[model samples]
Target: MAVNQMKNRMQALGLLDRSFKAASDDDLGDALERLDDEHREALESFVDEVSVDGVRAGVRTGRIDGGMEAIAAIVTDAALADTIEQLGDHAESPSSEQLREVLPGVVERHRLGVTRIMLAGTVVGEAPASAIIRDLLKNDETLALPPAPEVEIAPLLDTSKRSSDEQAELRAKRKAAKAAKKDAERARRAQSAAARGR
Candidate 1:
């Protein structure tokens, strides 16, 4: 819906038409599974709470599940509930086994910089990639490390001056090609309408 809205707004402003291709429905579904950092923290907090509560309540096996249920219970307001419902679509209203398969990958993706819920709707398609991210997140505490000093970043890669100029030249060429394509499309439309009248 947001993609369609963006395209429609662009068309209305005469910026572009429906020339952009989006990830397919299945890709979107996969992305829905790849939520961000705040979301992972939210789920983990729920798990921890459930673990604590289960210890107090003497429930033996379901601390994690109970914690999640408890967190769900806390989001009772209208706006939060709406957001929850939208995000729950990631759970995909499917079998437990599928959820189990996807949840670890989602958690792994969260550990990376992919923190926006909006982008999650795009990255979930590459399950293998997500799984690798998850494994790295699981085994590597580097994600848990302190932020590096900005001064240390310059030494990591060789600085190159030609890269930006070459990219700018390529961008200019692409813009020219796109303008010609749009002009041709407009001409075709006008010719087709004229032919219909004749």
Candidate 2:
């Protein structure tokens, strides 16, 4: 929960590409404006109580755990429920592509808890964000499907050189072979039935 540790967790959760060193007042104000009433209130309280210098001092003295308690309180089960509802409204079966499109907004809204759950790797039991992410990954895996094994149908049917009569002859031969095989199967079944009766 130290600043560095929190940063590491965020990175692991794909929440942060780079560490956040400092925020300008304008940057902070813009971030606050995006938050809901509860989260904004908690963040505002933290901002009110702690200055940049105060945070630096706290980090120096090892007093603050990166305001994790406040973050945890803000990102509650209710907040996660709201996120789930929002995601549901966004898509019925959220594809990875679709999720990626909307994920930034969702993460921006539920940053802390989503990061926490992603780091923990718990889906469904923890936050719905993790479950949503897991489902998207699963959908991606299903959709990938290994390109259908590159079936060599061209080799299987190389009739470009053959004449129409040759092709018709080949088709007739295949039909005859199929009929012969079916007759053999039927004969084998009749023999088996005779043996069973005896």
User: Candidate 1, residues 114-192: lDDT per residue as tens digits?
Assistant: 2222122112222223433333333434322122235544454453555988878978999999999788767755653
lDDT of 2 by residue, 1-198 (tens): 599766545533332111111223343333334557766555443333333443323223221333333332333334345444666765445545665665556556545324333223333223335555544433443211122234466557677999999999999999999999788767755653553354
State the weakest 10-residue window (summed lDDT) of model 1. 14-23
Using all chains and alpha carbons, the TM-scores for the candidates as numbered come to 0.21, 0.29
**lDDT per model vs. reference:** 0.34, 0.43
Clashing pairs in 2: none
| Each model's Cα RMSD | 21.4, 25.5
Candidate 1: pairs in clash: 30-124, 31-120, 50-67
TM-score of 2: 0.29
lDDT of model 2, residue 31:
39
After best superposition, candidate 2 residue 59: deviation in angstroms?
9.0
